[model samples]
Structures are given as C-alpha cells and as structure tokens.
Target: MEAALSLPATLVAKLIEDAERHGMSVDEYCRAILSESRAGDRSSAQAAVINEPSLDDLKLEQLSVERLSLTAVGRTFESGALSGHINRLLPLKIGCRVLWSLLSDEGVGPTIREFREEMWSRVGSLRDYLRMIDEDYARPRGDRLHASFPNSSDAAIKRFLNQYIIRKSGLNAEQSSGAMIDFGLIGISDTGRVQFTEVGRNFSLLSNPVLDEEDHRGPSLSADEQVLILSQIRTEMMREWKFMRHVLDGIHVGSNTPTSLLARINRRYGPGTKADWSASVMPHMRSGVLGRMQALGLVKRTFIENRVEYRVTPLALVILEADVV
Candidate 1:
C-alpha cells in the first residue's frame, strides 16, 4: 500500500517535474536512483576515486519517493523499509568535505537582463529566428552554420541555426540551446521570474562577448569562434585517437577480434565510469570516429590470415607519426 508521503509541496513538484523531464514516471526515476546507489556499492573500483556521490546523482536521488518519504510517512512503510533508505540514497562520503571542483567555479548568478543579453550576443537580431518562424524563411544551404539551423526555431530554424552560428562562431544549438530561456538551463520561480542557476551562468558565459576587445581588427571569424573551432577540431581528433587506440591496441597484441575489443572497451568506459556514459562503446565508436575516418579514407578494412583487421592507409601515416596516446 502506498503511504501519504508528507513531503514539502515544492519538493514534490520538483520531483514530478524532473521525472517528467527525463521522460520517466516518478516511480521509475526514484527506482533508478536506488538502483544506481546499489550498483555503486557493488563496484569498489569506482568508489576508490569518486568516494562522494556525484552532484548529478545526488540531485536525482533527492527526487526519489523512498528518500522524500523518509521523515513523514508516519509508519506506513515497514519498520526497516525506510530505516536505511536515506543512507543508501546518500552518496558515499568520508565526511562533509568540499573540494576544488568545477561546481564551485560557477561564480555569482546573472540577472535576467544579463541572461537575455548573453543570448542576444550569440543569436544576434531575432530577425533570423522570427523570419524562419513567421515568414517560413529558409537560409540558403551555403549560409547554414555547421550545416544546421537554430534548435528553438522550427524546421527552417533547426536546419539553419547551427550553420549560421558556427560559420560566425563554432558554437552550435546543442551547446547553446538556441536563444531561448531553456527551463533546463535556468530556473523559473512560482511567480514566473527567471532565476539564474549555476549551470545557466556557465552556459551564458560560453557565448562570445558582445564587444571583440582583443582583436581590434575583426578577422574571418571572431576569437571565440576561432577558439571554439580549434576546440572542435581537437575533440574530433581525440575521438579518432580513441578509435585508433582501441583498434591499434588490439592489432598490436595480435587480437583484432571485434568481440574481444568491445569487451575491453566496455570494461574501461562503460556504466560505472561516469553518469550517463554508454554501456556499449561500439555504437559511439561506429557512428562517430570509425564512420568519420572511413569517409575520410584514413583507414580501410582488410582480411589477413583469416582475421578481419583495419589497416591505416598511407594517407593516415601523418597521424600515426604522432604519439597516439
């Protein structure tokens, strides 16, 4: 039987909201937190390093019914049912310790006006956004930034937003969430005022500032875009490196078996490594680095001694010359 849980009205609302946002029922979201906590207990390897429960995991656990119902369920649940439930939900910690972490780096919150300004700095005149939505205007293929459009807009905007933004700067819709007040990024009060969250401030700062102070003479792309472009290139290279490393490691050790490689990769990077990391490394590698390298003709598949292997092409020699690790 379900108990009448005496949780703060606001906390209950937040739980329901978060559960919906994740596309899970409140019950499912709650259970997932418990499941994650239990899994953590079984893995000593991860616990050795990240002794504290990650902020993300803790927040999710805070939404769980078992946790929220702890104090005031009024004997509805069995005696030991909620006894250790709260302890299980709390992340592993030696003591209440704070560290020099990224969470602390998110400085003071921005005002609503500052939030709007930051968005405007990236998106520029809403002319493009409005034109797409109101007039059904489509930016030409050549004008597309990163070959995509803004996400907050309709098909026309979605198709063109990334293209326009990246050509001007390498920032894309997924990174910036277009120019809208994303509820995920910022918080909204019951009275309908925008609240600057830590994440919201970080996201706002990601966009290039309005005035290009350093580069007096504006170049082909703004400094922010150039930095972003370089970062993107590096990220692309790293992904390739990981894929290459996975394959090269196997090949050098005389084990190019796909199943064996997958097993090794999964052990190193699967579920316990980080929150929301893929359980199967194959899917990410397949469509990402492998697909890109194949399209670029940097590697080719070959059959050698009754085993399938990927050999680096002559064109990829330059890449191999560098220290892969």
Candidate 2:
C-alpha cells in the first residue's frame, strides 16, 4: 500500500528543490524527510528490540549492520538511505550512555578518560570492540573492502553525521541549494570544540578525491604548468604576508636548492617528499615565494638541455646583494 501525508505546498516545493539538488527523486526526498523525523522513535524501537542482548552481541550487530550497509553502498560510501540510517542508529545503540551524558548538562565535551569509561562500560576492551568493527567492515567482499575509512576515528564519524543532519535540514542560509565545497565531516574550531560545520554537511553528495592505494603513481606537472596551476597559492599567501616572510626567511638563510627544500620539509612532516610538502606545509610557499621573487625580479627559471633550472636574476641580486652582510 502507498503511504501519503498531508504536507504544506511550500514545504513540498522545498523538499522537491532539495531532492533535485541531491540528484534524488521526489519520493526519495519524502522518504529521507520521513526517516529523519522518525530517527529517534526508530532508534528507541531498535534499542528495545536488543535490550536483553549481551554487549558482545550488540557490538556484533553494530559491526554487522555497518559492514552490510557499506557493501550496499558499493565501497564508495555515498550519502544515501543506508548510510543515513546507520548514522542515525549507531551512536544511540552502541554508545547510548555516552550520548546521554553528552546530552546532559553535566557532560562537558568528553575527555579520553570519560570516553574510554563510557565505551568500555558497555563492552570489554574498547580497542578490541573497535578492532572487531574494523575487521568485519574492512574485510574484502568481492573486489573492494566492505567499509572505507576516509577519515579517522569515531569523533570523525559523529562529526560527519552531525554535518549530514545540518545539510539535510537546511539549517544555514548559504545552503539554500546547489553544490558546495567538501570540508570533510570533522572540523576543529578555533575554540577547540570538535563540531560539525555547514561546509561538512554540504559535502555529503560530493565525491571523495583521495585515492586508496599507495603505489598508484599519476601524472607530473611541468614548471610553467605548475606556475599557472599555483594561482590560488599566490592569492592565499598574499592574504598573509607574514607567511611569505617566514618562507623566504627559511630559503635565504639556507644554501639548499628547491629540490632539497622538500627533503628538509619531509624530515619534519614525514612522507610523500615534494608533493606532500607542497600540499601541506608549503601550500602558500609555492606561488608566494615564486611570485614575490618574480615581482622583485630575483629568480628566473629557464629550460636548458630539456631540464628546467632556476637562477637569480640580476635585479634580484641587486636587492639581495645589498641585504647580504
């Protein structure tokens, strides 16, 4: 039998708009809205159903549902019915006490000790419980693993869930409609509260860009190409002049070349050599250093014998020559 509800026209229009934005059908949108509204009630029912089960059994069920849903989602972990259903249920079922505490006035953001106590109070060892979940979810079904860990930790999972709620509910003015940036599910605010942002919520429909395998080598960028590519880098650094000074100061004091600069960064930050350093530590440095140097007419790169090499321009020497003590 088909179910029907008496919804206001305005609400129906908004739901239709949201469904279109997410590439879901109007029926799917209605289902999602209904599901979200009933999440707490449904969770209560689920809790009642498993109240008598041992903690091990409950944990096993949690792990099983997570694995099955991950499999159903095709290992890519798209935000849909299965993922949403799991998100709504898991925390309430597995970490009900902790969730209750968080809801309570006495619960300041849970510390590691508090978290451990809450987690282990229900189950045996927290690590073993987590390992069980991980082992089952990560086991290979066909070509890919059951569940993917795009971000680390349970806190991250919660953050993702919270973000999903905000996005689905349209809590913010900016999220009226259309695509937005993917800031991951978790965010650490300036005040150090681990919370979800509208940015994270909007990312539910977006694709995860990071590749899984380590050995999958991709294309390389050329010097001119890299320069053009780094326009965003230039704008970012210009926004913070102190960052530019900090980077230039490092290069000026050291005798190492650009290639060796990456090694120096890797010693402090670990792995991926130049690519890692460029993306991580020196994102501002790439175009910041080069653009500033070019503006001051200090450095120039030329292709010689099919190899790109950089040298200090005469104008750059004039400035640095005066600064040299």
Candidate 3:
C-alpha cells in the first residue's frame, strides 16, 4: 500500500527536470528523494522542504534547453560505467584549464581571460590541433592519449566557463559568478581576491592513469597535468556526443570502419533526405569523438589494407566491463 503526498507544482516540475538531467526516470528520482527524506530526522519539518525548488531551479526554468544539456549527459555517464572517472571529466577542457591555472599560480587563480589565453596558446592554432592529433593518434594502442578541442575564441571560452561550466559543476550562480570564484576550483574573498581549493590542486595533479609516455603532448607537463589534460579532452568528447550516445554504442570494436561509422551516425542524427551528415556530423565526430577516443588510449584506429579499422583498448574494456556489471 502507498499514499500520495501533495507536492507544489513547481517542486514537481523541478523533480522532473532533475530526473532528466541525471538520466533517471521520474519514478526513480522520486524514490531516491523519498529514501533520502526517510533517512533524515522525521521529527523536523525541514525535511519536507527538500522537495521545494530553489532559485537555481527557477533560473534553470528560465534558461534555454541547450544550456542544461550538459547536466544530464555528464551525470548519466558518471552514474553508470564511468563511475570512477566521471568526476574528473566534468566541464572537460575548461575544467582542467581552471584547475591547472590555479595549480600553477598556487595562490591567486588566473582571471577568466588569463586562463582562456593560456589554453588558446596550447591548442588555438590549426597547426597545433593537428600536431596534437598526430602525436596522440599515431601511436601504439596503449600509448595514445586524449588530445582534442573544439575551435574556440577567448570570448567563447570565457562565456562557456562562466555560463555553463560553473553551473554544471554544481556551483551557485548569483553568489559565485564573480571573477574570483569558479565551479569549486577557486574561491573569492571579501576584498575580491581569488584563491584555488585543495580539491582543484588534487584534480590538476592526477597522474596519467591510462595513457603512456608517447601520448604526452608536452615534455614540460607534469604527470598530473598530463592526466588532467587527457581527462579534459575525454570529457570534451563525451560532451560533444551527448546527444549521440546511441551512435557511440552502435560503434562496435571489430564490426565498424571509419566509413561505416560515419554512415551509421549520419543516418540517425543528420538532416535526413537533404544535407549530407558526412559534410557536417561525420567530420565533427571524426575529429571530436573517434579521434579523441583513439588518442585517449580508449580505442585503437588502424588502417588495414587501405581501410580503417577500430578496436577497443584494454582501458576501454574496463569501462565496458563496468557497464555489464
């Protein structure tokens, strides 16, 4: 037997939104909420307020759907197969940039522009992006590392960090959107100074857990920095394919080729009956997801007798194993 509890319309809506973001059905979300409520002290009436929507909920309500897309995909990956590594990948490149800038400074964090400029210097040039791809992809399966980026300008980077990364990382908007504070990496003081967190330092310091030495793009980068960069690149790839998980899943190790993968993905997500997905979606996925996965040591891409073939790496098998478990 069950009883229906009355809930505010706004609260119900917020639950639905949260459910969607976490890739959970409404029933699952409600069950989790009820379980949490039961675990708390029932004597206190405050537990009931857990269902109440906050200002952030209101802001999300007003914002467009694209802004909130990251929230769902990031969490869904985290909750399932990528459980151990998902936290390291949120906000992808931008998150790593923020953490690294904070780590290098060791005191005051870099301003939004400073961080963006540094990242731009690394991968801004078309030559640089291509070189990174070559270094990352033209290697033994176990030696590849995550190395890719969306073409972006300083203003675009700044906007993405402030408007998207911050919110997606679970930081408040109104109080934390100032220059000094960002997603949990940096904090602001009363005098307007900024300092990074221990969490940020640790994140920036993660050693390369999967890739090999040949995969490291820069000799100057510390092991932790290399790992963080790879994490960011991997995260960026996942975020780009957020809407196309089906295509990713469809791409089996021995069964798909570059041409076939492109065809399969285009059939599903492309502008059907008119524009070629090969002209648009295929190029983006080739450069973004498949290229990055090959670089990350997650997947191996090889040219066999003039045809390209893909195989899952050992590290990727770990993720697949988790999915089954």
Residue lDDT tens for model 1, 96-201? 0000011212322233334333333333233333233323334332222222213354554433332211111233222232112211223433332233333333
Clashing pairs in 3: 145-295
Residue lDDT tens for model 3, 215-293: 3343223445534544542453353334224434555543367677766656655665343344554556454455445
Model 3: residues with Cα > 4 Å off, grouped in runs:
1-106, 118-200, 208-248, 253-255, 272-279
- CA deviation > 4 Å runs, candidate 2: 1-258, 264-284
- For candidate 2, the 10 contiguous residues with the lowest summed lDDT are 67-76
Candidate 3 least-lDDT 10 residues:
67-76
Tell me how many clashing residue pairs each candidate has: 13, 0, 1
Rate residue 195 of model 3 by lDDT.
39
Alpha-carbon runs more than 4 Å astray in model 1: 1-174, 177-232, 235-244, 247-257, 274-276, 303-308
Instruction: Specify the poorest-scoring 10-residue window by lDDT in model 1.
Output: 89-98
lDDT agreement with native, every candidate: 0.35, 0.35, 0.43
RMSD to native, candidate 3: 24.3
Q: Which has the better TM-score: candidate 1, or candidate 2? A: 1
Alpha carbon lDDT of residue 271, candidate 3? 62
Question: Using lDDT as the measure, what is the rank order of every candidate, best first?
Answer: 3, 1, 2
